[model samples]
Target: MNSGDLPPSRPLLVVDDDRKLCGLIRDYLAPRGWQVDMRHTGPEGLEAASTGDYEAVLLDVMMPGMDGFEVLRELRKTSTIPVLMLTAMGEEADRIVGLELGADDYLPKTFSSRELLARLRAVTRRSVRSGEAADAGKEWSAGDLTLNEETHLVTLDGGNLELTALEFAILASLLKAKGRVKSREALLEEVSDRRFDVFDRSIDVHVSQLRRKLGDDPKQPRFIHTIRGVGYKLKEPA
Candidate 1:
């Protein structure tokens, strides 16, 4: 097919030991204009991800030598590239661990190619939107929490809070809304271009992580308040 017939090529890195699965992903995504680079080992994947100019990274939770969590931890030390983790089906703990370690999103190994494509697009879109917003050089503050959009840095009570890309997005949305309660659907829409699924608890997980970093108690949160049955809102400092 001619270049005009295909969308602009998006570079993606897949880090997984399953060569067969990587090959399948490459075959499925290549025709759709994604340049898929496969790394069959955690070290190789980490090296490529650190040095390569990839729009996104697909990581598997299980790997030999270095594991996905270790690779993710090392990568987060330098880069903020969007990452979509691949976890075994029914492994809720693996999903939570990936999210806690800064993964942009996660999908089960049994996910359809269509769902994979949709999630990849959603995460990359979110990253681009975040970059654009950051370029605006905006600063937001409520109470002791401060967020610098340009730097994508957040500070609570004069101390920096290390947040993943998704966590930062969630916090930014809540900060923007301030005292207004933001429904889970609204929050998800702001951070991802995908349709909302009531069953998805990814948002909740990220929010809980953010609260922990902010030292906000879930029951009596000083910065974020759960409206229960409604959603969450950033509390105005009294």
Candidate 2:
């Protein structure tokens, strides 16, 4: 199929060791205008993702052999295909790890399929956006920080920050709204290209990762500043 014919209503791969769940997802998603492919093993899932022409990948964190993190890391070495992870372990640490490893989103195992579908749409929408340009202000610069909305690229202090799209978006949003304390929900809504909800800790993880990449110390940040109990602001250098 043509590239234009593939996304928004294209095939999505579901990788889980639980065959029954995979079957259920395939059935549930098929009617919603998605072509679903199911796999019960990590290696197979990775292989399928690497070779097949799927628009997005839904990966389960705990598989018998390779595991989702391993597969995601391996896939990152080459492909930039969007990946959303499923985890039975709902620990914040696990979700942070997945995000750090380049996974787009993480869904806890008990999450509803309806929620999964919403997340899937959101993730795919983000992937599609990486190929396009943000409106009007497609480029933003402050001090030594620069962001290209068209290319989804960010550079800080004369060095290129190898940020994920979300990370770049988060930074861009902060820079765009410089001097304003943007709440976690506001940042999530701005950067994630979707609605903000209760589980907004993902924005925090992305910000933390961005801080590390930019060498901004939480205790003595030179760029992003945290408000006591509110949110974050971009510190424009003098």
Candidate 3:
């Protein structure tokens, strides 16, 4: 295909200590709309990813000098780049840890080419959605909770709350449709372009974490209410 006919290449960073694996990834993604960059150490990855140049990062869990979790935790402090964590096959704990540390998505280390592309696209899509929402409005509020979409800040009862990117998106989505039902399918579509798998509970998990940050109870909730089989709705401002 001619260069003009190819989709625009997105800058992508792959952070892994395995030199051979990094090279393999670069070869695989370079022509598939991703201009892949490789980083072999955790510190190097952290520095490169913090530069705000790449559209996404594929971070491996195991690395020398520093681990992926540590890098993700530190990166989240300053940047909101989409991060897809690569964990050892079946390491559910690692996946959970990565998500808690602000990773946008997870993939198994033995991932197929298709799976990797899908995940990379999904995380980037999520990031884009969040950025669009940020520019859509300055601030959204309900009761004592407030989210500054422009500033990417969340506060409850005047106290600042630390929230992950996913948490922020979930909350912002809820507030944007305040007092209206946001079905799980609709919310998932907004977050990523991935195909729907009803069994996926990541959205629920994120919402629960957001509620904990707001000190909201699932029963008689103060900010978010579960719409049973539908999805969730943010309580309207009092």
**Model 1 poorest ten-residue lDDT run:** 1-10
Tens digits of lDDT, candidate 2, 38-133 = 888889998999999987899988898899999999887777787888877557677878888888788888889778877877777776676678
Better of 1 and 2 by TM-score: 1
lDDT by candidate, in order shown: 0.87, 0.80, 0.81
Compared with the true structure, the alpha-carbon lDDT of candidate 3 equals 0.81
Question: Cα deviation of 223 in candidate 1 (Å)?
Answer: 1.2
TM-score of 3: 0.79
TM-score for each candidate, following the candidate numbering = 0.87, 0.84, 0.79
For model 1 the local lDDT of residue 70 reads 96
lDDT of 1 by residue, 1-238 (tens): 5543336588999999999999999999998889999998999999999999999999998997899999999998898899999999999899988887788899999999888988888888777766666647788889889988887778888898777667878988898889899998888888876566877777788888788888888988888999888789997777
- Candidate whose TM-score is highest: 1
Candidate 3 wrongly placed segments (more than 4 Å): 1-9, 133-139, 147-165, 196-199, 212-220, 227-230
RMSD of each: 2.7, 3.8, 3.4
On residues 59-146, what C-alpha lDDT tens digit does candidate 3 reach at each position?
Answer: 9999878999999999989887888999998887887778766777888888998788777766776666555654756888887788
Question: Can you rank all candidates by TM-score, best first?
Answer: 1, 2, 3
What's the residue-level lDDT of 104 in candidate 2? 78
